[model samples]
Target: MTRLVAANRVISTDGKEIKPGVVELDGERVVNVSALLGERPFTEWLGGTINLQYYADEQLCAYKDGKML
Candidate 1:
């Protein structure tokens, strides 16, 4: 699986602008988006906490143990 991460702007709850500097992903699918919020180390590292993002799939791929659906 391959994924790409980039920066984008979004409107925050406080009506401020936020940036998702890095987006965590799994195999051409987005698993989480880390916004530029929270404390220094956290924000500086993974950028921010994980906020979920979704990708289009005809069927959800779920796995159990070490198998692929």
Candidate 2:
């Protein structure tokens, strides 16, 4: 199954803070990390995954089908 992790801020492996980034995952594997400049909303990066973890303001929140899990 595919999973997604979106955060208002992501601390990169290189020790950089990626503000408002999105990470894509496939099962237990990471597929992509997006922190580009765009006109996209958080909903746009959202995929059809029942398992999603979102972090905002240093708080971790999980969502299942758009509802808190």
Candidate 3:
């Protein structure tokens, strides 16, 4: 996951504050990010649990923890 903001402004909706902008993805699809990395600053957020065990043939294998989820 990666977060980016336009210049100095953060992305917001409905006057709700969302800072540090981020993009969360599952496989190739995007998912919720605000609740996902709520604890870290948006500019400093990284997927909390990632265990990439392999990289081959331009493919990757990753894990969040034991049992694959």
The candidate scoring highest on TM-score is: 2
Single out the weakest 10-residue window by summed lDDT for candidate 2: 43-52
- Summarize candidate 2's per-residue lDDT along 1-69 as a digit string, tens digits: 555566565444445666676665554444566674555443345433333344455434444365653
Q: Would you estimate the TM-scores of all the predictions? A: 0.32, 0.46, 0.24
What lDDT tens digits, residue by residue, belong to model 3 across residues 1-67? 5332111112322334334334343553334334333444444333344333333453333334332
lDDT string for model 1 (1-69, tens) is 534343445332244544754544465444444454534232223222233322255422222132321
Q: In terms of lDDT, which candidate is strongest?
A: 2
Give the per-residue Cα lDDT of candidate 2 at 55.
48
Which wins on TM-score, candidate 2 or candidate 3?
Answer: 2
Give the residue spans of candidate 2 off by over 4 A: 36-69
C-alpha local distance difference test of each model = 0.38, 0.51, 0.35
Ranking of models by lDDT? 2, 1, 3
Model 3, which residues run further than 4 Å from truth? 1-17, 35-69
Q: Which candidate, 1 or 3, would have the higher lDDT against the true structure?
A: 1
